[model samples]
Target: MKHGFKQRLFIVAGILLVVCAAVWLVISAISDNMRYFVSPSEIQAGIAPEGHTLRVGGLVVAGSVRRIAKGLTVRFEVTDNASTIPVVYTGILPDLFREGQGVVATGKLRADGIFVAGEVLAKHDENYMPREVQEALNKAEGAVDVGNAMRKSAGGSL
Candidate 1:
């Protein structure tokens, strides 16, 4: 009876260890794949992880979009009123991807200060701004409060 009990205990211990290991592996994998959102100001302040896939969102700077030599590649600058980051994308832009609009780009930042975007997300619905981008822009410019900004952009009274 003693021998049987000891064997059972050992089996239970092994099972528990395997379960713990699996959980740890899952958590680590999720963390490695997760992408964080940051504003242009945060990136300029060195808060974003360099060369790691992350999201930077802000308003597209007016008259900053430039076509690169008649190719699909285009360069533009995004700003949160406090700081700006140059972005390069080689694909067709969304119809709503115009100047002074909120935009989010997912990619890694280059050492030369250019954000090489793998994907660019533009405002979809009418008078819609991503919550994160709107908050960041509001924070950057105190004179332009959140309500005022939204109203001004939407061309409606708040």
Candidate 2:
């Protein structure tokens, strides 16, 4: 009976090891595919990963959108109002994409501080903005308010 118990223990340990290995593999795979969402201010603060793909959400700066190379490759600046990041996308933008609209671009940041976007997603409706973009804008506005309050307390002009 002791020998049988030892055999059962070994089997249980082996099963547990396999389960752990499988879980580890799944977690690693998911982590590798995960793309973090960040704002223009965060990008300006150097919070974005240099080479890893991530999502940036903010308003497309008015008059900053430009078409290059026959209008296929486009460049624009995305802003959280407090900060802006230049973005280059080499494909046709969404139909709703326009200046002063909310946009989320997925890509990696180039060494020259430009965001090379693989995909550009724009807000669908006039009243609808992406949640990430809205959150980023709100955070930037809050920062501006705090800055203004500090300046006022220090007797500085607005």
lDDT of 2 by residue, 1-158 (tens): 99999999999999999999999999999998899999999998899889898999877776788999686899999888789899999988999887776789999999889999999998786567677777777789554333333234334532
Clashes of 1: 0
Q: Where does model 2 exceed 4 Å of error?
A: 1-17, 141-158
**What does candidate 1 score on TM?**
0.76
Off by over 4 Å in 1: 1-10, 142-158
Candidate 2 accuracy as TM-score? 0.75
Model 1: residue 100 alpha-carbon error in angstroms: 2.0
How would you encode candidate 1's per-residue C-alpha lDDT over 15-102 as one tens digit per residue? 9999999999999999888898888888888888996899888877767899999889999998887888999999999988877677
Error of 1 at 62 (Å): 1.8
Per-model RMSD to reference: 3.9, 7.8
**Which candidate number has the best TM-score?**
1
